[model samples]
Target: MNRKLICYLLSSLLLLLNCNKVMSASWEITYPRTSSDSDKSTDYPLKVLALALEQTGVNFQLIPSEKHYTQGKNLSRLKDNREINVVWSMTDRQREKDLLPIRIPIYKGLIGWRLFLIREDMADRFKYIQKVDHLLKLSPIQGRDWPDTKILQANSFNVVTNINHSALGPMLSNAQGDFFPRSMLEIWDEIETLQTDNKLIIQDSLGLQYPAAMYFFVNNQNRPLAHLIRTGLEKAVANGKFDKLFNQTYQSYIDRTKLKKRKFYRLKNTFLPSETPLDRKELWFKPN
Candidate 1:
């Protein structure tokens, strides 16, 4: 072949290869690891998700999000820059907005958690929040500021928002706050190590349950890649790779005994009477 003809052929082949090359997909796992020593180990769960893709012969990259960008805006920026292709866990409206949910759920949240936490000494003062009007009568309950504020505000729950769970104990102990209502698991996790003095108690009497589901959120524009991830996860689950991953990454967290180390007492507030007299007018009042 002539030299010029050979050059033209090479260029065409290069263009074709570039066009056919599979785009690299990556993920940023947002949850924090247990500690600095365990940072690299945190990548294992995401690698499990990646291993599933590998089984399907799908070549992609898995990148764990830096612990510094744990949640909210910082995490959003990592996705905006295309630094990561997926967020490991996110909830409902979040899944609908910025990302697409593939068929397989990386994890499922507990159906719902509604536990009211109180200073151990003050459990008798405030009980489950039954009537919306009754809650309003009780002033200054303790709650976390972020989602709690929005959730409480929407439901018209009368409560004061505290930035951290740690603050609630001292505030309630000092009589500055009423019952601290929040997700059962959240408060339970916080009080696990701090329960040495019988300082805190979690009461699941409010009956306010929030269901949170975990999903892999891919950017909206990357729907095709999301489908690939779905296919990979489906195959993984069928082949038992998913179960192996769950055991390896999460068995410790799911242990009921370990999870229940701190007693989460279910205190029935005076409002919830176990036995109602047959003819009590208030108990039998029917909505007209």
Candidate 2:
């Protein structure tokens, strides 16, 4: 080969190798973890995130942050693009303004369907409550930083706030609060895993409902990632994978809740952003 042709061929090969290296590099996606290593609530959302990335045919690694952080701290990290790149949280106006949201409700709006976790002996206290006003008379315990606290308080419910999520269960057990309202998707497993001496049970007959969306959010600068996640989630929904995973993970809980039989008092979610995709009926869960 001529010397000029040989030099050109070597340069082309090096460029091709660099291009391949760039294409093969995997994006490292980090998610936050709570203090509890055994938190099962994170499992479904993690799986859904994996499914979304899988749909995109992207090379990526899913990682849990080594340092435990509170939900508020995790969100702060996400906003700063520090340790965590993505976090799943219930959407509110402030959060939407702070981060780039995927906009697809990861929990299919089930996070707003709440069941009261009350002392087993306190069952009759709620039995005769016929209206939301009556229920409002009972104070519910919630995390101090959680949006649910604001939402509950906004609706005139006297809310007991604790800084720690793990403490809420103990507070409810110790009668520090009248009840602990938990999402239907969460209450079952939480009750099963609670290590309190007090016997807590899901309140029967009465429930509360609101419109909320739990979405995966990234830093505002990470628009590519946000778009990638939204595209994958939408494609999953189109091909039936999203619903399949949703049912597989939560259908049993839904069935156990007996949603259709419960008398649910609907409450207004003032924290819900106006841009929420409420018009998309298929994205939400409705009890038959």
The top-ranked prediction according to lDDT is 2
Off by over 4 Å in 2: 1-23
Q: Name every residue pair that clashes in candidate 1.
A: none
| Residue pairs of candidate 2 with colliding backbone atoms | none
Name the regions of candidate 1 deviating beyond 4 angstroms: 1-62, 82-84, 92-95, 103-105, 126-149, 159-188, 193-198, 204-207, 237-288
Q: Candidate 1 lDDT, tens digit per residue, 25-91?
A: 3433333333345234336546756776686564555544454443344336534744556655434
The lDDT of model 1 is 0.51
lDDT of 2 by residue, 89-179 (tens): 9999999999988888989999999999999889988988989989988989999988888899999999999888999999999999989
Give the worst 10-residue stretch by lDDT in candidate 1.
267-276
* TM-score per model over all chains: 0.54, 0.92
Model 1 vs truth, CA RMSD = 11.9
Error of 1 at 179 (Å): 4.7
Return the number of clashes found in candidate 2.
Answer: 0
Global lDDT scores for all candidate models: 0.51, 0.90
Per-residue error for 172 in candidate 1, Å, reads 6.7
